[model samples]
Target: MHRRRELVGWATVGVVLCALAIPWFLWGSSTVVFGLPLWLWWHVGWMVLASAVFWLFARRAWGLGVETADSSERASATASVGDGGGSR
Candidate 1:
């Protein structure tokens, strides 16, 4: 039941994102704010960005382990990071 609810919510979000991007991609120039041209790319970018963030959040909550990087890769990144030691 919980999974279904999360899926439905995500699906609704994805649909809304697509709706925004598709129409903007098709006819975006007319929609403007303060004389700035509202291009389709802008909408597409936002939709994509939002989806990525939401996916990460949901994956974490669902324990899906769907991060942008592999575990080993993340480990390597951490290994290469600055020291945890604080100033004396």
Candidate 2:
């Protein structure tokens, strides 16, 4: 329900929708899914799916809290700048 989870959920939906609706070349064969062509699914489907699932699991494990590493890194970097807005 937070920004991070919301973004990931939207991303998962977007990728899956794209895979089910878009078509592309693959070994000169037309790969299909749900009678439609798979574009993102061809290479990133499983990975994204796994990531989505993992994130969902992680969210639950962490009591549905947003403790992503990137957010922490960003916060630390900002704090280190001390509000001077580092310009280098």
Best by TM-score: 1
lDDT of 2 at 71: 57
Q: Return the lDDT, model 2, position 80.
A: 71
lDDT of 2 by residue, 14-67 (tens): 576566443344645666887655654555666666577668656644422355
| lDDT digits (tens) for residues 43-70 of candidate 1 | 6578778878678766654432243234
RMSD of each: 12.6, 10.0
Lowest-scoring 10 consecutive residues by lDDT in candidate 1?
63-72
Residue 68 in candidate 2 has what lDDT? 60
Task: Report how far residue 44 has shifted in candidate 2, in Å.
Answer: 24
lDDT of each: 0.56, 0.55
Best by lDDT: 1
Error of 2 at 12 (Å): 0.3
The weakest ten consecutive residues by lDDT in model 2 span 79-88
